[model samples]
Structure formats: C-alpha cells, structure tokens
Target: MPYVEVSLPVRAERSEIYPILKEMEKYPEFMADLVSVEVVERKENSTITKWVSNVDGRIIKWTEVDLFDDANMHISYKQIDGDLKKFEGEWILTPVADGTEIKLTVDFEFGIPMIAGLLNPILKKKVRDNSLNMLTAIKERMENRA
Candidate 1:
C-alpha cells in the first residue's frame, strides 16, 4: 500500500470551504484534470459519487462513497469500485488565523504483489503528486473566490 498526504492553507473559513467541498460534483468545473463527478446516490450524511479523472492522458474511473462530517470540517471517501485495486482518503479543515488549513490524505495500492517492491516507490510519488494537485486546485478555487 502507498500513502500520501498534502496540506495547504486556504484563504477562507471552514464554513465557506465545507460547502464547496460538499459539492463534489462541481470539482471538474475548477479542476481541469477532473473529467466529471456525478452524484449516484445520496443519504443524510453520505453520498455515492461516480468520478472520471484524467491523469497524464490516462483516464481513471471510480465510484466512491463520501461521508461528510460537516460539524468536524472533514470529509472522507473510499472507493467502492474503480480502476485501482484500492483508493481512499480524507479531507480535513482546521481554522487558522488567516483562514483554514486543509489537508488531503490518500491511501492506494496497485495490488500487484509481484511488482510491488519495484513499483511502490514510483507509484507513491505519483499518488502524492496527484494529491498535491488536488489540494492545489481546491486552494486556487477557494482563494480566488475569497
């Protein structure tokens, strides 16, 4: 398994950031690498979302369940089905003096045990870069809006 985490400060309140984060389906509008995000199902505090993302010209698709913890300023998601063997992560926001500190953590695995040793390092970097890209995208959007 490979794990990666990235964090950045956003010029906005947790209150403002939480809603935009809750609206997962609007990601593509601000994140160019995201192809689309559709709400497949909804529950009181969770949702099943279908996602299509482009990474280095490769398309990756997945359906994930997202649980929103508005009171805690957090949201976590795990893939139910996807191109990857495993994918899960969480977004956490904490109030900071100037704004909010947002963190994105991703855990993933390619599931190829035979090549795990050889690929884990490379894959880990890729996942980390992707995670950073996601945080960067969100920060850009929220900061510009503020």
Candidate 2:
C-alpha cells in the first residue's frame, strides 16, 4: 500500500468551503484530471459515488462511499468497487488565522505483490501529483468565489 497526503490553504472559512467539497460532481468542472463524478446514492450522512479520472493519460475508474462529518468539516471515503485493489482516504478542513487549511489523503494498493517493489514508487508519485492537483483546484475555486 502507498499513502499520499497533500494540503493547501484556501482564503476562506471552513464553513464556506465544506459545502463546496460536498459537491463532488462539480469537481470535474475545475479539475482537469477528473473526467466525471456521479452520485450513485445519497444517504443522510454519506454518499456513494462513481468516479472516472485520467492519470498520466491512463483512465482510472472507481466507485466509493463517502462519509461526511459536517460538524468537523471532514470527509472519509473508501472504494467499494474500483480498478485498484484498495483505495481510501479522508479530507480534513481546519480553520486557521488567515484562512482554512484543506488536507487530502490517499491510500492505495496496486494489488500485484510481485511487481509492487518496481511500481510503487512511480505510482506514488502519480498519486501525489493527482492529490495536489485536486487540492489546488479546490483552493482556486474557493478563493476565486470570494
């Protein structure tokens, strides 16, 4: 398994940013790497979503369950069915003196143990870059709105 975490400070309050984060389907509008995000099911505090994203020109698809903690401005998600063996992570929003700090994490497994050693490093970098891109996109969207 490989884990990647990226964070960005947005010039907005946590409360102002939480709602935008909940709108997963709108991500594709600002995120170039994301092809689409569809909400398959919506629950009281969670949502099941299907995602299609391009990573270095390779298309990756997944379905995930997202658990929302509105009070804490946090969201945790795990793949129910996807291209990867395991994919899970969380988004955390913390208010600071200047603005809000948004953190995104990703944990994944390529599933092929034999070649894990050879591929993990490259995969990690790609994942990290993707995560950073996501955070940057969110930050831009939030800041520009204000």
Candidate 1 structure quality by residue, lDDT tens digits, 1-146: 88888899998889988988899999898887889999999998999999999878889899999999877979999999998899999999988999999999889888789998898898788777877887888888888873
Query: Which segments of candidate 1 are over 4 A away from where they belong?
Result: none
Distance from true position, residue 28, model 2, in Å? 0.4
Best by lDDT: 2
Tens digits of per-residue lDDT for model 2, 17-102: 89989999999999999999999999989999999999989999999999999878899999999899999999999888889999
Query: Over 4 Å off in model 2, which ranges?
Result: none
lDDT of each: 0.90, 0.93
**Per-prediction TM-score to the true structure, in the order listed:** 0.94, 0.97
Specify the poorest-scoring 10-residue window by lDDT in model 2. 137-146
**Worst 10-residue lDDT window, candidate 1:** 126-135
Checking candidate 1 for backbone clashes, the offending pairs are none
